[model samples]
Target chain A: MTDRTPGTRSSSGYSAWRLIAEELRAEIGDGRLRAGDRLPTEAALAERFSVNRHTARQATATLAEDGLVESRRGSGTYVTGEAMRLHRIGVRTRLTKSLGEKASASGNLRVLNSAVEDAPTDIARRLALDGGKAVRIETTRSAGGQQISMSTHWFDVSRLPDIATVLRRTGSVTSALRESGVDDYVRTSTVVGARHATASEVAVLDLGQGAIVLVTEGLDSLTDGTPLQHVVTRFAAQRVRLDIEHPRAD
Target chain B: MTDRTPGTRSSSGYSAWRLIAEELRAEIGDGRLRAGDRLPTEAALAERFSVNRHTARQATATLAEDGLVESRRGSGTYVTGEAMRLHRIGVRTRLTKSLGEKASASGNLRVLNSAVEDAPTDIARRLALDGGKAVRIETTRSAGGQQISMSTHWFDVSRLPDIATVLRRTGSVTSALRESGVDDYVRTSTVVGARHATASEVAVLDLGQGAIVLVTEGLDSLTDGTPLQHVVTRFAAQRVRLDIEHPRAD
Candidate 1:
């Protein structure tokens, strides 16, 4: 740790617990505090921040509520955010491959649903469709029996007519496309963000009531640059980190 | 519209309301349902899902609670997610530059806190520091008078002893570093992810009680790869999306 004063008395209007919690959160986020590390006792925290014990308790309580820390009944409070596993994205960026061995159930991908649908305007544009319907595939991927991500992929039906069935059989989008005679597709673009897990996401991903999901929208194309698939994938934020790789700069 | 059934009968053990909510969430996520769009009435939703009105009502209520949809008295339920704006990251992903003009309050950057601290191991390695203290600068970024991100940037004190004071004075990291005798830098690595907003984040970012922050850990180095700064930035997920550009595939 810094050994310097908190120096994080950054917000004037925020509550005392808030500033303390933010400081602790930053330490945890940056690895100065790791999982299983015991936090200072309430009295210690109180003296350190020049606040009352109750205020210190409130700060720890806030971290506990967010699953960032856990308060043992007798033992001291401890950090709980287990150094998030990294998910790397690059020129090829395949979910199953990028997730590596970490995303597991023994690591399996399953098709939850599939059907043909009139392309939504946005999906159609991304797939470069010309008045044709698209095959939609919904899937869930798990690691250690916990759902890691839910992906919905859309493909131009005229080009990959049996993509839905093939995906179900192959249990892999990359393989499904290859079976449909389109081998060696490349990721064209990726847009990332985050959002609160919805009610459905909570139940399906088995997340806590107010958890968050890291969302990635991607497109893959033929070597010739023809758009082949559009996918929206949401990963359990608590479990995944994204590593973006770039070529050396000038 | 799909012209087909919702096709989201994806979950087996989940309740009827959860299935309906999940299907609706996917539509909203993919832009089939956009901001300010009126959702089908409860009666319509029940008929479409083969469920009862109460089940349908529960679904809409959940969306309302998450701020994804809202009930407008007798008018009807409608989608409320505002089509997230994009934040692009590249070799030189300057927050002020990447955010363009969308991040507001006249788009000014200000120091929240600055100090000299013993460098944490992870940050020490990132900045290539050698047992020396580091200059830490904490900042919050805002747009439209709303906080967008909170960042903590660390620089090796031995190499840039005047960074903290310089950053506070210039109010711009790029300009501050230039004045510190480092005229050129390149972003060599970036790791992105998301997490639920901590108590402090909710207060400073002016987010809903249960919100998420899109996080990016970045490392910038001088032209010859001598580490310059290590920053951890957390953005309000509701307001910003990250656009990651890559070199076209082979």
Candidate 2:
């Protein structure tokens, strides 16, 4: 039943399944397993690991749980293209990376609108600012010259000392934040939902009447847990997909 | 320090933190705590639960881990809308419900393309069919009036009798399979990925050039583990967010 030669194992007392999963995970991480590659069957895997069918199945399930493999009912299991790509660090990172990857692949981002305004009540509360003290940055992002999303990110002016100067000079909020010395931060929370696009969103995104919108609001904080930013992004439903990678607990 | 009346429990059996979390969870499940509703400060929760500040924070952390609440650095935790609305289930249930929900959300199916062509080598192997014998159905779906997603589902004609008649009459593939007397079935496996949309997918989805596509491919099987179907769905990136809720084994 062995379809591939069993690799030499290290001295540690790891289970056959763990060893096999590590091998496959290494391959995926190292870029050897491309998106469309087909993996060996369970029987073959069992033989290679010198284990029973149950152990082989468990190993395969581990990979599947990690979003690494796809199995068809009558068809065999195969590697998915999505599993080959590296996910961004946090929710916002995921969003920005997804957009950047797609945009870089076939298009470019265009700044449709850029403005500074008073933070909305929700944003104000999220940023922990007095009602009128929070500053909001609004930008409409486009790909291939077509608008895809509108983002409004709020920052507490008390924390961000020179917002207007940074906005006028750099244009990228992330870059500005980093330049301002708050480089180490993690996404504290993300809330996502879907609804019909508003008239302005429809006009800007060029969406049809029936098109929906996916909304994501997130908060980011420093390591010591100081809330740094709050951002809300709305995407034209027809144009994008949001993927979240969930690692299984051991 | 009590901000509001304590819940049914005034127990010292469980830790005060545990009691507080249970109360909040019950509130969320019962819809008393709606999405976007902010919780009271740590001091307030501490007073209500008769717990120390650290214990109250720990309770909030538990809620955050379950994706039931969002905690900003300085701002208090708030209920997440999606967390309240969507139930994260296993991969099998996700695939089944996704199709059902998509169809329900999008009122009609528009046959973007269909053919009785030879399956690609990868697809043929996936369906366990001779390369040329697999029948493919390609459909684009729309909600209200605008396009939302595209799907390509395949079946081996040799295994599925009267495929054309079933497709023509039932409209729903799951229903078609049910009518064919294939009552006992389960999703054997699923693969998921995110990527830049292809030119064809972009056109079919009406997505902007930079929009990401979330793709899910799976196999459904009979109780005896006989493969029944292979299906692939491409969702417009901005329209949907994939959530996988894994149970912790602690």
Using lDDT as the measure, the top candidate is 1
For candidate 1, lDDT tens digit of each residue in A102-221?
A: 553223678899889887787888887878889888888876545778888898888888888878787777777778898798877999987757656766776653456888998888
Ten-residue stretch with the least lDDT total in model 2 chain B: B5-14
Q: Tell the DockQ for candidate 2.
A: 0.03
Model 2: per-residue lDDT, tens digit, A72-95?
A: 787877887653322232423633
- TM for candidate 1 is 0.75
Residue B105 error for model 1, in Å? Answer: 12
**Candidate 1 local lDDT, B1-250, one digit each (tens):** 3221333333212355655665676567657789999999989998887778897887787667556798888798888854355777777766676665655322367788888998778788777777888999999876555566888899988888888888777777888888989888888888998765765677677765335678899898888988889998888877788888777777
Query: Deviation in angstroms for B62 in model 1?
Result: 12
lDDT per residue for candidate 2 within B160-183, as digits (tens), equals 756556755655565677788776
